[model samples]
Target: MKIDTLQHTSHRTNLAQNIARVILGGFLVMAGTSHLSWSRAEFLAQVPSWLPIDADLVVILSGVVEIILGLSLLFFTSRRRQVGWVVAAFFVLIFPGNISQYMNGIDAFGLDTDRARAIRLVFQPVLVLLALWSTGAWQAWRKQQSGD
Candidate 1:
């Protein structure tokens, strides 16, 4: 009876994760699309001005990366753990842009107010957590580390 209950709970948890993963993937794809087209200008606001790299070029390349990552999340079930890590790393990589926006008071994405930018900064970790959680990467890594 305990085993059955455990199995059922696991199934439900897996289902929830799968759904969250798919939703995240879809969001990424949409965000990537916007980065390339409709929202291109808005994204430029996030690029750190001090960075030597061309802002437009950075945005374009990042958009491509986002699209690829999103597709990977949608189709790379076999390598979900690795994909999750990559996604989490990507979030980390772009965190500086969020920081820059706040520091420079660059108003984009309706984050004009300092309060808004500060609030946005707080969500970066949440995205990292979501990527790891939705992919089961955090749990898998923990389990492997524990040698369980």
Candidate 2:
């Protein structure tokens, strides 16, 4: 099936959505900074042992990506939908790391218990949904799918 290049173009976000987007962006920027700096070691605990890449390298690269995605969300008005999709996918891509943390019972970011880690896992989808909803990506895709 052919994909429409324009299918994920951005739409105007209302005040609440815009606020949420900005907050999410700020959160990403902070987390990314932590990955590159003080929290680098903490983030390492999340890297799955089976991943062939050097764990440090993975952390560093993901940090960079998070920063870029965060900045895009903060400033890319005409392309927020695209950025939202990318951000959502980024969350999904990194989900395995969270799973690894849980499976290994690795404690980091104050998640010292299995219960805490499991709860953190639950928030991953919330972040994904926030990216979609705050940027209007979810609505845009639904409209397209329904042929509206």
Candidate 3:
């Protein structure tokens, strides 16, 4: 059995993917923390009445989940695909929150308009892509991870 230099190159590529995961994970943690720091009333106002939980609790819990998922990515590099799955789940779960924010005219870090809020919605998939990229799924699947 002969292992060519290509194997070493692929190994390095995987290592780069792992590093990207850590960077993205740290970024997500910081973003989630910012949400946590938001005024509870402001966030509460954004939550729709249809959701079961209190608005304040929902806002806080969402931040906690984001932070946890982000941190998990850093520590669970070997399970990149599994982490991606979890992250995708989080994205789906929080999507309603994003919609609520948009509909309620909530200013998320001063993003006030529905258009601004709606534009922000596009990034959710990009975050998922970052997660999937960490798993090298895009490489295997031949899909554009980011719209750009």
Highest TM-score, which number? 2
Return the lDDT, model 2, position 104: 94
Full candidate order by lDDT, most accurate first: 2, 1, 3
What would the per-residue lDDT of candidate 3 be over residues 1-148, giving only the tens digit for each residue?
A: 7433221113223677788888878976876786589555565666777998777788788778878888888776555565766787777777777787888777865678888999988987877777777756445344332312
| Root-mean-square deviation per candidate | 5.8, 2.4, 6.5
Worst 10 residues of 1 by lDDT: 4-13
Error of 3 at 116 (Å): 1.2
lDDT digits (tens) for residues 1-148 of candidate 2: 8656345444567999999999999999999999999999999999999999999999999999999999999998678888899999999999999999999999999999999999999999999999999988998888777766
Clashes of each: 0, 0, 0
Candidate 3 clashes between residue pairs 3 or more apart in a chain or in different chains: none
The 10 consecutive residues of candidate 3 with the worst lDDT sum are 4-13
Candidate 2 achieves a global lDDT of 0.91
What TM-score against the true fold does each predicted structure earn? 0.90, 0.93, 0.71
**Candidate 1's C-alpha lDDT?**
0.86
Q: What's the C-alpha lDDT at position 99 in model 3? A: 84
